[model samples]
Target: MTDTGPRVRRIDAPRQDRQDTETYPTVARAVTAARRLVHRHPDRCRLREVGRSRAGRPLFLLSVDDGERTVLAVGGPHPNEPVGLAAAVGLAERVLELPPRPGVGWHVLLCLDPDGAALNEGWLHGPLTPARHYEHFFRPAFHEQPELLPAPDGPLAPMPESRVLTGLIDELRPVLQCSLHGVDFGGAFVQLTRPLPGLAAGFARSVARGGIPLDVDSYDAVGWDSPAPGTYVMPAPGTRWRALPDRPELSTWSYAGRYGGVTAVLEVPMWAIDAVGDARPHPDVRAAVGAAARTLHERIAELTGLLPQVPPHAGVAYGPLLRAIEFNLEVSPLLVEEWLADWSPAPLSVSRVTTARIVAQRLPLRIASMLLRLLADSGGPAADAARARARGIIAASLEGLHRLGIRWVPIGTQVGHQTRAALAAADLLLARR
Candidate 1:
């Protein structure tokens, strides 16, 4: 499965020169910048409200092209993954600057989950570190995630934000949809709704051009078909939907795929780990994965044990954090157990070992962070004691991660890689047609 299509040349997006290179912009800041960009180019760009979030924040759509064929770009599907927001903005700017194509229009959804994104803004003003990120971390639970909600037309009603996306899909029926996404820590990768011959090569090249390591084996890349390293073929709706927690519900990419559009999920990372791309065989695959599973289970037990001692009610402000802890508690251990069960004596790559360790160690920090946030928010003598204990756990986890040798990737670097990958994807779509 080589790239049978034309060779993909490296694409480099213009570097951004913001005051704080390491920090990402808040929802308000990102939206404001997007509006200003649209406002600056009256003829080429048009900004309009598409829908409202659950919390009543307006979801705006920025249309940069009026061509017959359309390319749909969505950002911030997961609020915690804000790299895409900056990428979306950059994409819109690039589209505006380019000479008009014959019939390829571009529509950019700057931020899909504005309410959820707002919750994560605390870390936006950061000397961004692993410790700081988890401390201010927030992610809606499975049921609350817009992209993970049941189908818009299903018996289970979709979230207000998801409905907006469904409606947009119906209206645009785009030729290509780029769902911009990012991870807390990993090398860069892309997930495609289906095979688009040369797209993966372009995406890989884009990652290289941005000086980012290619994540050859991501945690989610396990079950997918890969024509190239760092690129995965996401199973269509009915194929592997059951593998995920929310069965039968289509993600944004799958939803777009239903309309005969190809989706390229540009997944970058905030923290960089070059080891994730190493193809060298791990010395002991079974032992590495087994150890990772043990580490995860141990942490899960310790964290879940603390819950009984603390108050159940942490208020609305900490709901996301609470949900994160609850969801991870139920799911993380099971995932690790399943992985261990499924393991065999195969040629496991170093990247696989790195991914395993990341899943085991870093994931628990998120859970610990959520617990700490919940405890801190409760504000009582007992809660204070619990918070202190959680902080100790977090400190140990952070120290463990430091030993893993992960590096912090600048926000601009992440956005640049995503923007380039997206542009490359768009090119592949046009080339396919």
Candidate 2:
């Protein structure tokens, strides 16, 4: 379907009447259309207020069901990642028109962090500006902005929206969870659980079929060397930490790990989604993407049966690993800048240097840490095997850095800092012992 021009149709009108309108626009427009959709299709869809965002926006959950399996998809965990919200709203509209598979259920949580999203609206519609400016303003980068927004009482905090999400997860216990996100100009790929063997390939096919080119070469866009495709770098220290105890963060993959279900994160590049700029999807690509979505949905449903329950060790080793990542990030600016200037013949993009520091230095340390835990947990030959695996992962990662042509000074002293932090975190993790 291609767009001829902008046209308005009544919400209660037939799907054909609404064909000209884009599903995703500004938040207000999306919410208004969605509310109208629920009202029009009362039999198939129900809208519920899950919680209030920090700014007091009503976070709505649109539940579409055929009565058996439940799938929950969420968007807008980070203020800048708004495409997911658009996609979620679009998917909701599609679900209403099509007949659901017998026993299938879908719940879409639209714009989980409206407060963060509201802060991002200024840049959403217009001449595309530089990403750095948006980063500075939205504070999507962890260290760039205050961890929590200020409130009249105190720090406004992550808000009850996340808490309510956790509660909903506990109650509904969705079999499959997909969080939608968009990469900046570079880095593009759909991410699912790390350990799943063929999931990436399957997802890539779906994306290609959708007419969006797979960004196989753009790994460095998000951090990490070009050699290692799937890895993303950790943000610098004083930036946001990825994992924290007793807090509900938007890193819902960890949440899925905790809940023991299959979780997938679809990272689409904004360019791909806006390929035609307010135009309709290309007919062939739209057919492919729609098919891919359906196929993926079915595959995820099937995988749910095979998914293992959350293991005690699932996130148990993350504390020390997190500390290691943090330590690397803390020392990265000096080491990475020097390495990029001397070793790399080309002047590196500032973002690339920042990203590489996290990927090359910090990530290896984090992996080494998990190995330490594995050694402690396993016995006899299992310990030996764990050590070998850890060493191999670390070696491969280091080799990846060398391949990327990054040379660093003897910052071995940083390792000691990492060690101390890891030890402290490990102690805390063990204290609960």
Candidate 3:
């Protein structure tokens, strides 16, 4: 693959500031900032209490309405990916500065999962290194996630947060909706609800300008059709290739489809790994997948085996860890089967191979961290023994991951890239109109 590194983009209205942001803000601080933004610009911005999180934290929507058509941006859809928290606020501030586009309005749902985000505050203010990230990591199980849950009519009760989003979708019927997300380590990539000509290239270009590598070989990207490098068409719900089914709840994009608007799931990396974008071929693709699958399976087994030993604790604090472990156990096998079934003689991209290895290395450590928390929550001889074992596992996982030499991307750079992509997407939608 021809490697033309990140290019500079010259623009006027939406530009990245020189502020070098080092650490992510905690959920409370982020919410306060959003409120302050509205308070400072009450004329252009309106902050409203849309709903409450399960934990009863009031969720607010900051609407900057100087235009007609609506563009909805949901931040912190996943508790672990807090890049969006900053991006949502930044986007609002940037848009307010520009003369409003006559055809477009911006509504940002700042910090969708505030309760879950609070759980990840340990590493939110960073020394954002790989070891710190894994040690402080937390992700809710799919069932607990608002975006992944089904509509309210199923066997499960809909998350209060999901209800807020769906209600907004129905009310605003936005022309474009962007879900902000970030990966722990990889290049930037995006998934769209439908084909939007040149939108993918626009996304790639924005991140590239930030000097963030393009994750051309994301395993999730592989499951969908790409119209451009680093951009994939989100597979329809119930896609057989998807390791986990949406089941009771439809995916956010699918649910948003009813309003005839487009959805974009934009993902940037917390840590930049150039190997994740290298398009060179791996000599033996199947062998690489097999090795990753075997390692991941072993780790899953080890973690799951310890699950029963730790007694169930009250409160939802450790619920995310348990949910995440369950999620991995359910999805890992299906993911491996799909990758192997689709195997071909043609070599796989080096980025794909690298990502496979990185995920295999990191996931176990992530689970171990969660397990440590779960173990710590329990009080017993088994729990004490499990805690010791979990620590040893985490130490080994961290040691192996550190050897990979992942480089950290400044929080400011990540926010800039996400902000640029979102603004560009809004522009494309207005242009199409």
lDDT of 1 by residue, 101-194 (tens): 7677899998999988877788777767777778787887778888766755767778899899879988999888888889877789888878
Model 3 scores worst on lDDT over the 10 consecutive residues at 1-10
Tens-place lDDT digits, model 2, residues 149-173: 2233444453476566766677667
lDDT of 3 by residue, 1-433 (tens): 1212222222223465532667676767767887787788887788888999998998889899756678999998988888888888877877787776665679999888988888888886667666676667788877788887655577887789988998999988888899999988778998888987656666766776777889887876666787778888876555564455554217666677787888888898887778787888887888887777777777777777787865655325466677787787677666566556664333789888878777777777888887776666577787788888888778877675566657778888888877777776766666653
User: Model 1 reaches what TM-score against the true structure?
Assistant: 0.91
Least lDDT summed over 10 consecutive residues: which range in candidate 2?
Answer: 409-418
TM-score each candidate: 0.91, 0.51, 0.90
Give the residue spans of candidate 1 off by over 4 A. Answer: 1-20, 151-155, 236-249, 309-312, 315-317, 344-346, 379-381
Q: Provide the overall lDDT of each model, using Cα atoms, as 2-decimal numbers.
A: 0.77, 0.45, 0.76
Q: Pick the candidate with the highest lDDT.
A: 1
Comparing candidate 1 with candidate 3, which one achieves the higher lDDT?
A: 1
- TM-score order, best first, reads 1, 3, 2
Q: lDDT for model 3, on a 0 to 1 scale?
A: 0.76
